[model samples]
Target: MSSFDNTHITALTDLINKAVQDIIAEYASAGRAVPSLDTLESGLFQVPEETPARLTKAIQIVEAACAQLSCTVAPPGSVMINKSLEHEEPACLLVVTEARIADLLLDKPEGLPASELASRSGLDTRKLTRILRLLATKHCFKEVKPGVFANNRLSMKLLSSDTVSSIVCLLTDESLRASAYLNETLTDPSERDGGIPFIRATGYPFFDYHKTRQGLKKGERFPRAMVGWGDVTGKGLLAKVYPWTSQPANTTICDVGGGNGHVTMNLMKAHPHIKVVVQDQPQVIEMAQKFWAKEYPGAMEKERVQFIPFDFFKDAAVQGCDFYYIRSILRDWPDTESELILKNVRQAMKQGSRVIIHDTVLRDAVRTPESSSNASVHHDVAPEPLLPNYGVARVRTYELDMTMMNLLNSQMRTLPEFIELGKRCGLRFEKLYEVGETDLVEFSPI
Candidate 1:
């Protein structure tokens, strides 16, 4: 479609969304039951049992009214598609505001009214007012009055003061920036530079910049974020997938490239029988010790888990561990770098040991279109045809693949790609486990 057509479609979609929101609001105001999907699909505000002809005419009227709006009323699947594509302005706004609000909420846990927030953020009050209104509508914040805002459950979850939220802040911004340069980065050879990739348009590789940021210092927001994500994913993976409890009593689980020992700690907590060793860069290991040592107290004296300051890329120091668990680390590098890391990891593993690769994997699926019940129908026009299902996960994976291409020179590996890479390093690919649609592929020394 032409740029004008795209703009027109976006405008029309926005109008329909606004109309739908208004209809729902009206229903809320009236304390009446909201109309059902069947009612919407039939194009009649209310079903008429007795007057079939009038019902048909009303349906025509409703369809016509929607048609007059000059755009397709997106189907349920299309809503998800729109979200995945980040096509809607509101979606992007939501993401940006969520990040900013999370930072603000962490810095000022007491929270701020919209006026005060606008003042502190140096944002225009009028624009901030509009944005907050949108956020409040989506339950991101609670609106006490016309211009006042307060933290709601959703907003609180984004706070950097917490571990997961902090990591979310770091990753989400990097994701956005990478996405912004996706097209150019993919098409241009000059985009790739010393593992930095296309995001250099912003002037530095993400890791280099991330390392330099004051927020990333030991005991600062970034490590806490990493710890938070590690805690969440580690616990979830251990409970759902890994058989940590089934391992032998003498087993030593090495978390290679483990950050802040979050995963190691969680694994230790879950499988008390398993001794854990976490290895990473010297700086990260030092911070990891300080954070976990303080939190666990005498557990370090007891040696529940040992933090080893060694880079997995440099040498395989923590060898002969029963299981080598690497979570979400390999996906950050390209095939060549990943091969190098795997080779190093392989040198550390024993004959019977397993290497667990845990990260997000994509699947292919198609979208289907349907009409919106929330839209106001004009009496005279015909409704537009619904859009076709473009496979969603495929699109998302490609987009993310391009994003990683730009930001870290990494790519999301397909099942076959994983197998191929493993073969090159003399590691045989083993069974794959499903972790909420993401495949956790196992590798062993061939």
Candidate 2:
């Protein structure tokens, strides 16, 4: 009946306390206090420099150790049940987002009664109270009083206005539905003809499904969701992490399969000297045109941006650009199709041309000789008593890996996988850039 012995518990306790001290010190050094979870604004992590190496490591250790410690002490059945029901919290979140509860409570810092909130959102009062209470217990929204609900720092992110909400809805609705069919898709032998779980759930592959009349109505939210995808995955820091300023003036940076051209827009805004070519399907190109026009009219006026409708699977990317950037594109396809896409970009490369792929580069839970060899980018592993991949701290990337598989029968590649994929396309691994949430793998002609 006893859990991890004294030594194990002590190790975890020490790790947590050490991490907490490190975090507190970092805040003190910055002349700032550790942010309150209730405050409705950006926290320390918003400022990249504020979350430097020491602070980041500490935060990871704290997250992993605390969760591990809890699991170590908790009943096995209790933990298993909690993990099994994880989907329910997000389902509640979907309800809150769909009802615009966050937006309604935006002005009500003190909070709103559950009955009033339910009436405004057109939901049953008792049901709404239960949902809000569940979310509150999860630290999303807060139950300020006996039956009153309010927006907290976390709930503010669910505000209908934020781009994060788009991705949230997509994941909770379409992706969630697709995920439900994962077991069926994996088991059914007849499902092998490019019929991913998403297709099984909707009777069409992701793109084709989105093109249908019903899909079209829902797909309108998708472009913005793609934009929100960038925001959620730390694409805003892409320009800063990479050496955009080092490139020559007017250097053309081609954004291959760039939906809404969010990455290039960030680059152009940060380093306006660079010219950009945003390439995708004709429909996406059309969307990119409007997006660029509305978001950065001056760039469109000055011809600093170009919209090129090109399918990577069938056509070469814009030739001879200094950098051909592909953000979160390859993860949507299996290795065979991913290679074809890369080969097209490979064909378009000139002597100095480089391909920069921005996606989740997964790390193994334990170190290996192969992982060591492919270590172009240094990923910090957690110390003893924590999962090597930082367990709950880095679970989002692993969850996204599952999401890719469920939706497209694809995966987020490991460094070794990425290196091999590039080599197959006649490209050599150059270097890897680790932005907080994702990794950028750079390649050049073989």
Candidate 3:
């Protein structure tokens, strides 16, 4: 009959106020305007920063409360029922992209008629009108005038040249295939033998499928899409969060499996004094070279960055770097392969060297509250009466965990699991830098 109890409501109020003040103060200090929901750019999420960890945690806590409380107050089927058809949003998007409707709308901010959009893209006018109307219902595109379309912030990402378009393409393409066969993959011997649903649906494991001459372009699209995903989702905040300057001057930091050096290049750009090595498979290394030369000419010209071909299982990691940094790398493999990769890094380390691992550390279903005395090592927990790990706010991480499972037969890991694996390679967990759902853990030589 009543809303949440006094304690829960009070906590939510405090968290909301704290987050508001902190965000305002953070921006004001930098002489910038704080974000607002009315503007699309401001409405986006960012990876949290330790400089304002308390503020970041406050934001996560209150947002989770908002979602949970809103739903809790409503009847079961009211808000929850429609989510069953969430896939239709993407299904509609597949049509938008295939027809390049977004591209056609890009220059027509005033809006272009559905008939003209159809003519340019070669779809039937009536069919294109229905599809755009479907998307416009969800605000993906705006119907500026009846039966006319234009790019709004949401639809802009689907433009032909936008990196986020690549992300949209990859997930819908991959996730749709995997979802269809996921049930079969679990019980069918042949499907299980294929290793994952992506393999079963597409006739190859995710990576191997990407490398086929046909797969090469889509394979490349996924990484570039990651760059966009990082931008939108706040995965790019590491350059600011990491204590890069703590290392001595001229220190070397090796980016293991650094695809196209997107993350590594950000680090090099931000911390100019450090040297970076971008290592990956030979093909990726070649691409990384071109990426650096094109985007960060100063890095190669000044000898501050190097690209080297590498295979983690077969060779020792680039030797004697002060730091070995792995971002979004280890989760692609299961523990056994993960161990071998770490052992290689272990062999490369000098006496005082460390490894910086940037990955999601899965939390317990029920967790020690962040306010608890025992929570120093725990990931952030949701306030009770909401799921402990924050329910839908954390949907993306769980989705990613499944993405790893579906494509690679791997997963996101727990901190204890990380500890167990680290012990096998003689490394000790040194510290955890918490920022939203992701944690950057430092590992030192045993």
TM-score-wise, the better of 1 and 2 is: 2
Q: List residue ranges in candidate 3 displaced over 4 A.
A: 1-63, 77-80, 107-110, 189-193, 211-217, 293-302, 369-388, 435-437
Arrange candidates by TM-score, descending: 2, 3, 1
- Cα lDDT tens digits, model 2, 1-446, are 26645877789999999999999998898888888778887766654433677888888898899999999999999999999999998898889998999999998889999899999999999999999999999899999998999999889889889988888888898888888888888888886646588988888887787889978855887877876776655666787788878888999999999888977897899999999999999999999999898999999999999999988889999888888999888998899999999999999999999999988889888856654455566566677767778889989899889888887788999888999999999999988887877888999999
TM for candidate 1 is: 0.64
**lDDT values of the candidates?**
0.60, 0.86, 0.77
Candidate 1 residue-wise lDDT, 323-406, digit = tens: 887877888887888888888888988989888787655432222121122122111112232111112212444665666676
- Report clash pairs, candidate 3: 47-234
TM-scores, all candidates, are: 0.64, 0.90, 0.83
Distance from true position, residue 438, model 3, in Å? 3.4
Task: State the lDDT of candidate 3 residue by residue for 180-225, as single tens digits.
Answer: 6777889886545456888888888787888898788788787777
List, in order, the clash count of every candidate structure. Answer: 6, 0, 1
Candidate closest to the true structure, highest lDDT: 2
Clash number for candidate 2: 0
Off by over 4 Å in 2: 1-5, 47-53, 192-195, 211-217, 293-304, 369-375
> Model 3: what TM-score?
0.83
